[model samples]
Target: MRLRDLAELVRAPAALSVPGDTVAGAAAGGGPGRSTPGLAAASVCLYWGGMAANDWADREVDARERPRRPIPSGRVRPSHALLTAAGLTAAGVGLAALAGGRRALAVAVPLAGAVWAYDVRAKNTAAGPATMAACRGLDVLLGASGGRMRQAVPAALTVAAHTYTVTVLSRREVEGATPALPLTTLAGTVAVAAAAARKGPGALLAAWYAAGYGLAQARAAADPSPERLRAAVGAGITDLPTLQAALAARAGFPAYATAVALAAPLGRRLARKVSPT
Candidate 1:
C-alpha cells in the first residue's frame, strides 16, 4: 500500500489531538518531565491505532456508507489495517513502559484495551461514547505515570468530557442529527470549557476553545444536516488542542500552554488536506 493510503487508513491528521491529552496530564500531575514526550508519542500511537482499528471494524459498513474510506476504497486492505492497529498498539504500550516503567504500563495496557474494545465491540452499542471517552481519560493518566496520578484526575475528566461530546457528534457524521443532538453536545462543550478554565491564562484559552468549537456545534444545531454534523465533528477534533492548552495553563504552564495551543491552527490546516473526522 502507498504511504498516503496508510495515512488515510489511520486518519493521521486526527492524531494531532492526541499528544495534548498527555500534556494536560503532565501539567496537572506535576508539570512535564523528560518522559512526557515519550508518553505523548505513545498516546499518538494508540490514537492512530484506534483509528485504524475503527476502520477495520467498520469496513463492511464503510463499503455501504463511506465507500471513499481507505479500506472500502480498496486503497488499504482490511488485514493490513488490522495489522497496523495491532502493531501501533504494541508500540504504544512498549514505549509507555520504556518511558515510565510499570507505572505508565498500567495505564497504557488498559487504554489500549479500551481502544480495541470500543472499535470491535462497543462502537455500535450505546456504550460507544463512554468507552471512547474512557480511552482518552486513560491516555491523560498515562502521562501522569511518574507523577501524582490523583492530581491528574480533574484534567483526565475534562478531556474525557470533551471526547464524549466529539464522539456523540461523530455518530451522526453519516446520518443527519436532530437539533437536540448538537444542542446536547453543545451543553457538554460548555461544561467542559468551564471545567477547564480555572484561574489563569487558561480561562482565555478555554473561552477560545468554546467559541471556535461551540460555533460549529451551534451551526450544526441550526442545520441538523449530515454535512453540518460532520463539520462539527471535524471542528471538535481539530480544536481540541485549545482545551488541552487551557488545562496546561490552569496547571501553571503558560508558555507550554501557548505552545500546545499552536497545534490547534495547524490541526485545522492539516484537516483541510486530510480530514480529521
Candidate 2:
C-alpha cells in the first residue's frame, strides 16, 4: 500500500499540509515515558476493522471495477475474514501497549475490541454511521488524558470528520446522489469550530492543520478521475510525516501533530492501492 493510504488509515488529519495556515508549535512525539504499545496496536486493529467493513460494503463494485484486490483477486477467503479480524484485534491491543502508555493500552484495547465487533456485526445496520463515528471518537478517548474537554475535542472531531468521509463512501454505495451531505457538513463545521475553540496552542495548531486536511480529503474523495486520484496521491506525498514534523507544526504545536496530519492522505493512497482506484 502507498504511504498516503496508510496515512489515511491512521486518519491523522494534522498530518497533511494546507497551502495557507500555520500549525501551532506544540511538542513533538508522544510524551516521554508514555508508551502503551497496546494502544497503538488497538488503533491499527480498529482501523483495519473499519476498512474491512467498508470492503464488505463495496464488494460488488470492487468485484467489477477492481478485481485484483484480496477479495476480488481470489486471494482472500471469506470464511477466514472473521478469524483474521479477531486475531488482528488482539494483536492490536498488544501493539498499542508497546506504543502508547499503559493507561492508553488499558482503555484503548477494550474500546477498540468493542468497536471492531460492532463494525463486523451491528455496524452494517441502521446504526452504521453512528457506530462508525463512535468508534473513531473512542480512539481519541483512548489517546486523551481523561476524556476531558481538551482530550474529548479530538474524539469529537473524529466523529465529524470520519462521518463526513463515510458519507462520501455512502454516496458511492448509492451509485451517486450524495447521502447526508448536509449532516456531514454540519458535523464537520461543529468539529472544526470545537477544535478551534480549544485554548492552547496545541489545539489551535491541530485546528489549523485540520482545516486544510479536511478540505484536501474531501477534494480527493470527490474527485472522479482515477488518473487524477493517482496524480493527487503523488502530490500528497510531498508532505510526508517528516516534513510535517519539520514544517507544519513549526510555530505552535508539537511535531507529532505533523505525524497526525500525515495520516489522512497517506491512508487514502493506501486504500486506493489496496482497494483499487
Candidate 3:
C-alpha cells in the first residue's frame, strides 16, 4: 500500500507541535502575517524526522510484532519506508522555500537533522524523552525566528507545554506498558486537549480530538484479541494529526481545512460519530 507508506510518512507522533496556523500561514503565502514560517518549518522538520525515526526503530518493532503493518503485511517494503521518510525531509525543505527569506537555512536545516536523530534513536534511549523535550523547545525557537517573532510566542508556548506534558506523561503514565494503554493514552489525550484549550474555541475541538484518541486507545487496549491490541494501539497512533489540526484551528488560522485534508475519509467518517451533536 503506497498509500499506507504515505500515511506512515506523515509523522503522527510530533503532529501536535507542528503549529497548524503557522503551516496555514506558510501555505497561504510567505513572510510575516500572523505566523512565523521558520517555526512551522521547524515543526514540519521535527515531524518528518520523527517519521524516519519510527521507520528505523519503531517500525521494525511493529513489523516483528505487528505482521499486519504495511512493511510486515507485504503492503510495503523497507525501501519504500525509507523513501517515505526521505520525502518528509524534502517536504520540509519545500515548506521552507515558502518561508520568506528571514530565518537562516543553516539554523533550520541542522535543527532538522538533530530532530531526526532524537526521533529515531534519542526517543528510545533514556535521553529520548528529554531529547524530544529539547527538540520541542527548539521548534518553538524555530517558530520565533525571522518574522514578527512575538506572534509566534503563543503557538510556541503551546507547543512547549504539549512537549513537556507528553514527555512527563510518557515517563510516568506509560511506563512498563500493558493493556493499560487505553487508560494511560486516554489520559494523555485529555491532557493534550486541555492544553489545546488553553486558548478558547480550540477547547471544544481539542476535547473532540481527545475523545477520539481516548476511544481508539480504549478500544485497542480492550480488544478481545491480544494480537489485535497491538494493532489497535498502532492504529490509535494515527490521531496525532487530528490533535494537531485542532490546535492549529485553535491558534486562529484556516488550518482546519488542511488538517481535515490530511486526515482522509476515514477520519471524516469517524468525525460523524465523534463530533458533538
Number of the top TM-score candidate: 1
- The TM-scores of all predictions, comma-separated, are 0.99, 0.58, 0.59
Question: Each candidate: what lDDT?
Answer: 0.93, 0.44, 0.51
lDDT for model 1, on a 0 to 1 scale? 0.93
- Which 10-residue span in candidate 1 carries the lowest summed lDDT? 194-203
Can you write out model 1's per-residue Cα lDDT over 84-135, one digit (the tens) per residue?
9999999999999999999999999999999999999999899999999999
Can you list the residue pairs that collide in candidate 1? none
Cα lDDT tens digits, model 3, 36-153, are 5445654565575556556555566666654655566666667766676667666665565456344634445755676677756676678775666565545544544554445555
Kindly state the number of residue pairs that clash in model 2.
Answer: 50
**Model 1, runs deviating above 4 Å:** none
What tens-digit string does per-residue lDDT give for candidate 2 at 1-277? Answer: 3454333323323223221111211121123124323344456565565455444444566689756545565555444444455565666666656655575577656666556656556555666656655655555455442223253443334333544344334433323333244335435544543534444544554454445434444554465344433333333232223223332233234545545555545645554444322
- In candidate 3, where is summed lDDT lowest over 10 consecutive residues? 268-277
Ranking of all predicted structures according to lDDT, beginning with the best and ending with the worst:
1, 3, 2
**To one decimal, what is the Cα RMSD in angstroms of model 3 from the true structure?**
6.6
Give the winner by lDDT: 1 or 3.
Answer: 1
Models sorted by TM-score, best on top: 1, 3, 2
Clashes of each: 0, 50, 4
